[model samples]
Target chain A: MRSYKDIHNILLDRIKGGEWEPGALVPSEADLAREFGCTRVTVNRAMQALADSGLIERRRKAGTRVVQRMTRNAVFEIQLVRHEIEQRGGTYKYLLISRSEEKPPQKVRAEMGLSGDNALLHVISLHFADGAPYQLEDRWISLDTVTQARREPFDAISPNEWLLREIPYTNAEHVFRASRAEPMDAEFLNLGEGEPVFVIERTTWLSDAAVTHVRLVHPADSFRLVTRDQHGTAL
Target chain B: MRSYKDIHNILLDRIKGGEWEPGALVPSEADLAREFGCTRVTVNRAMQALADSGLIERRRKAGTRVVQRMTRNAVFEIQLVRHEIEQRGGTYKYLLISRSEEKPPQKVRAEMGLSGDNALLHVISLHFADGAPYQLEDRWISLDTVTQARREPFDAISPNEWLLREIPYTNAEHVFRASRAEPMDAEFLNLGEGEPVFVIERTTWLSDAAVTHVRLVHPADSFRLVTRDQHGTAL
Candidate 1:
């Protein structure tokens, strides 16, 4: 109860005081509980909360240790389309192909937390890096979440920009997976059948309510994903 | 300098000791340098490294503050096929469809960091979940890296299994994207040519060099990538 909150504050105070530096091992659950004069579960809850905040790394046998800063967040920040284009030495361009209304599928309905068989504003477009095919984006928008979307013409603007302008979002869920090239996908993406393609699907939300679900696909032969890693030693 | 190593150790020590709690601002470069009795570059290196490790958040104007672990490295240990299947509430099954050596493509050769044009042991296979098309995997192995391949009927065994047994890997990089289904990709995945699919590509390394690359594509509507957030965060 209040003791746990006090424990949390004490723990935060110690960390802020630089007593437990990054990559340093803290006391075990038992040790923490005994020192704080509280049950182990309370200590466990505090430590778990700290770990969830990205302050420490937990290992089964090695116990928990603070993480080094070098191992932090995806270095590039979610692969901004602009940086990706510049890296290829190409000027990035975007075009909104079309926008239409349709009922969302079961998954989108559930993911977006839509109650009824609600209709969504679907936007399709192409992204080009140096005047070449970069990504084919097909997105479904929940009009209930963002009413402004119903009036926007996605053609003159990219769906990304359009969404960012018209909607204020709280969180986003992302999923990346691979799949084979479909004929329509191939025609839009300029690939042959049986060809491999890279796909990234992202869903943005406002609290527990989902907002937009977008699928961005790239021809496998045309894209590369890069990230820097610390040479093992991250807890 | 020997102090540089001690610097990382010390910084980590303070954080774990609770002196640098989550969201607490850190000392400036000049101040840290003065404290460590090292060059500003050394402190910069240390703090930069700390920031990189995700122990602290830094912005031009916001200064540096202890970061909470929002992401917490959802370290998905994508298991071997057997493990993936076993976890899926189904009987695990694997089949090796084809194998051969081919002159690796220019891009693939580059990915493998191979010199000039080289032949690669191409392994193709399919795994089943309850006798349904679970996954269609296409993999390319560096012949020069692993010698155990020149012989064996992989029909009963899987390349994923063989790789784990015969090859020792030190690192792996994964990417996911979405694409339209092609005829072959559609047929194998049991989807229409225009259907969307999820694709994941993984490159495995033995030490610093790549040993193999694999591409996995799944029917989009069939499944969703599942993960729980460590933060009370959505997305």
Candidate 2:
């Protein structure tokens, strides 16, 4: 006999296949049980799981309905720069501007939950797509966690790409905001000072251990971060 | 008899409880089955579910381990303005600046996938948080979907809130970007022109019926949209 998981998959396929249009009422548990030759309890389990995933809506009077594909919230992938550029059929390039061992700035220290006098790897790099500046990355790495990162030549590979291969992180935090381009950012990203820019700040951790903190800036009109559904609809 | 889902929940509790830290290898399926008093197949099913959710990484020779929490993507809620302000312990105020029926601009019409000559209800409103301008809202409502909206007084309730209560929309598309504050937006948001602004554009639909399109703009320093995991970590 097929389990509830199987039933769940079947129903999910139906939804993904557009078998039931959004907002259309689906069969009740009893009806579904009869159709699948299963107990109502099994059908209920399947339906409940669907509801939890926001694929369906159930009410006492309304029964079950395929949820109108609402503007969905999607977890977007933190894509790799090389992959993003390559996917767009552009030549990808990386430039390591500077690398130094220095005390982290106050804000970086606060975000990493570090106190005074802690040394960190401060690195700045530029990523290009089709020979045009794509993003400017400013990063700080925890020297305590990945000690070997201090010696690796970052000119060959971006710090982010290198860290991913060397250390494994278990948690990450990301912040998205808008900012006017500073003079330094303007020089790197080739945008005018004070132009609107999309800023992404990320902190990764290995359990409770802070691994790295990075800030990426992209020119507003040139780049956009998108989240979407399986049907390619913006979510 | 307990189902695989019960085993799944038990394992999930262990992960949440920090019994196995991120990047720690989990016990094999056979061992898990022995501990839980279940078949290995049941344990496998539970493990598979966890892997699907990005909680665990499974490899052929290396075995399963807690996934390094990479930069996570999250779905952001298109929250109500009143709820947001009230939650933040501020007074919520709304002002209807203008209301008219007119043909949408080319860009707006293109986004809604509408052709020429269709009249939409255009509305401009400001949301205030504690007597300060919180956001500027420019909206276009499709007259075909909600005919009664033409006569409803918007002075009392914002169009977004009203749509949520009255209409049964199933889908929405959202675009988040950064833009320079235009002259009108600078005046409305109490910011200097050319300052950065976070902009969110959303299009809501009832199945195939386009319902509304709205653009919300907030001053860069005053507002930010955040996405996070349940643990309050940014995702």
Top-scoring candidate (DockQ)? 2
Off by over 4 Å in 1: A1-77, A97-107, A116-125, A132-136, A142-157, A162-171, A175-199, A217-235, B1-77, B96-109, B115-126, B132-157, B165-168, B175-201, B215-235
Cα lDDT tens digits, model 1, B80-196, are: 667777777888788777899898777777666677577788988888788877778888988777777777567888887877655655456666556666676777777778676
Question: In candidate 1, residue A64 scores what lDDT?
Answer: 81
Q: Residues B90-186, candidate 2, lDDT per residue (tens digit)?
A: 9999999899999999999988888767899999999999999989999999999889899987999999788765675546677778888989899
DockQ of 2: 0.31
Q: Is the docking of candidate 1 incorrect, acceptable, medium or high quality?
A: incorrect
Task: Return the TM-score for candidate 2, rounded to 2 decimals.
Answer: 0.78
What digit string (tens of lDDT, one per residue) describes model 2 on residues A1-235?
8788889888876775568767888988999898889999889878877775677889997799987643345556666787788888999999999999999889998888776568999999999998989889999999998789889879999997888655666566778889989898999998899888999888877767788999999898777676543322222
Off by over 4 Å in 2: A1-37, A54-72, A115-117, A229-235, B1-37, B55-72, B230-235
Question: What is the CA-based DockQ of model 1?
Answer: 0.09
Q: Please give the lDDT score at residue B72 for candidate 1.
A: 30
